[model samples]
Target: MQIMRPLYVDPAVPGMAFTYVMATGGGVAQADRYRQDLVCGPGTQALFTTQAATKVYRMEHDYATQRVHLTAGEGAYVEYLPDAVIPFAGSRFHQSSVVTADETATVVYAETVTGGRLARGERHEYTVFTSDLEIRRPDGTLLAVDTMRLRPEDVGGVTGPGVFAGHDHVASVHVVSTRRPAQEIADTLHRSLADADVLHGTSVLPEACGAWTRILGHEQPCVTAAVHTAWDAVRRLLLGHPAPDLRKQ
Candidate 1:
């Protein structure tokens, strides 16, 4: 535990939520960051988020890495929704997550990123951002496999008509709920964002198949608003109330 990290959370919320960074492998880091930990108890509702965009600075020796562990209790719902991560040039980082969910649990989680503040001449031309994610049931069996990367030459990023669609700031929302029809929820979300002055799209997958939504636009404001709109609509229909915990500052 040589690497010191900042871990934050607000248990006073409607449910339980936390985020922090802790030492992982024996790798020597040129610097440190705040890691996150999030969870929920039976029948409890929780939302977890980062205070701001997590920045991984350049490393001259070895790779800086993070591992996240998440769980949701029976009849509980949780969201670890974090904003985009901006990596500076030459920075190397690896992120991985293992999420376990009970049969009665429901979750909506997402992670996104931008190249950088291009307006101010900031760009992550030669930087590398990598995240490997997996979802599992209570028994520890696998449910999904996701490998994501952001680089100048990597096609490992999102694509296709249902994916990024040429937008810079992109998001992937994974909702696990059976209380309501996923298709109906996505339909209403699309209709809600139709008139907005933004370019975006949404999709609904099968029950065991998690759903995905892609929003592409220039400004983060528009993209963030559109995502919130969808999250809000789905929350009311499924959780019996808007996600008060997911609201942004």
Candidate 2:
């Protein structure tokens, strides 16, 4: 089955929650499929999340796929903060998300997957797992693209220097704008990022008329927590939202 939701971007939603509920029994049968997507309109703000870790039931041959598409218009902001994804024994899954925003827009996105339920002492033993993310501006201006993958009996490539850099969880926050004084904002964020535990960095993309900040950490929750905090800082410094009312925890 397929599910989709569209919410206005203005006033952003409280706690900005996005959730999905499964009705089928445990373990997906062969050739089964599930899909979900979200869309936000101009001047709108939203945050997307799922109730709990998604499970990929065992599949020996074919892999399941999930595709998400988002649209944010001018002066809008959205965050994709879904819960963890869990792949069960011998299962395979492919995940991809693509987004395009107007010039005056902001996006904070994060995705995480586990080899298996670790509490059950499961190690990395999946057939295949992957996540592909990309974003651009209204005029087809590219901002950033990331592709990550893992397989059974092989070391995951998320730890690459240009990528996750040995961190299990990966996240990226981007702001697209043509406003001047880019240097000033970049400098301030750099100073505020002092002594952060995660390997974090920020860079401005004038060609795309925006900037991007990336954070890598050992735990998924830690990476998301840091992103939430950074959002608060940016809202306070740039958007002028008070500390608590910036982005709901």
Candidate 3:
């Protein structure tokens, strides 16, 4: 694994700082394991993101795994947005991210998944793909959990009415903030993507901590744009500001 020093970016919200550039040393390979831990102190704000898309190469041996642990202290704010993950044929991979934060803390997290290398006509050819995300309060009370265990062969097909529904890319975003109303945030995001070329849904999370959104689109760019729309709405609803361009080259 590789990690670059965090740089302060201009935050849309005053007093909130942002940073970047943590990534895997090399493309993920069979039998590889990666672990990352981040902590945000009280009243601090920061952002974390990967340098590029995570590519899972073909595997003839064991699978690869990545685990992330994050902690946000009282009144802290954090945003974790990683690029999409693309798995090649015969690849097996698993990744999980868990966050523990105080009730007053806020977090915005997102994940994107592509069917495969679309240019190569590869879609849902991976052996196994599993992912899990969880959020908990400081007392260890579970707030939300999102899990996906996908096996194309066993599922008959990865894209269908019940599955991805013919979409080549899928994205999800979660907003956790005690300061705002969850239903309001959900409504805002639902309306934001109503006319988009993507299929999406938004709902409030358990305990009313915040809201969550899932979007599916046939094209990578459309799906990514839809996800960003939801993220932007969340920022506006919670921070009372517009989203800033990440300026990711």
Identify the leading candidate in terms of lDDT: 3
Model 1: per-residue Cα lDDT at residue 3: 24
Model 3 clash pairs are none
lDDT per prediction?
A: 0.64, 0.62, 0.86
**What ranking emerges by lDDT with the best candidate at the front?**
3, 1, 2
Candidate that would win on TM-score: 3
Q: How many clashing pairs in candidate 1?
A: 4
Q: Positional deviation of 61 in candidate 2, in angstroms? A: 2.3
lDDT of 2 by residue, 114-205 (tens): 54665676645567778787787767777777676676556544345665455555566655444435565555555556656677788875
Question: Using alpha carbons, what is the TM-score of model 2?
Answer: 0.71
What's model 3's overall lDDT?
0.86
Q: On a 0 to 1 TM-score scale, where does candidate 1 land against the true structure? A: 0.76
* TM-score of each model, in listed order: 0.76, 0.71, 0.95
Q: Which stretches of candidate 1 lie over 4 Å from their true place?
A: 1-37, 153-166, 206-210, 245-249
Write the residue-wise lDDT of candidate 1 on 1-249 in tens digits. Answer: 332332223333434444323234433244544344556678866666655566565577666777777888898877777666666556777788877778778887776766665575666553567788787888987776667766655665443344445555665666766566767767766776787656766777544434556567667777777777767776777766664443336
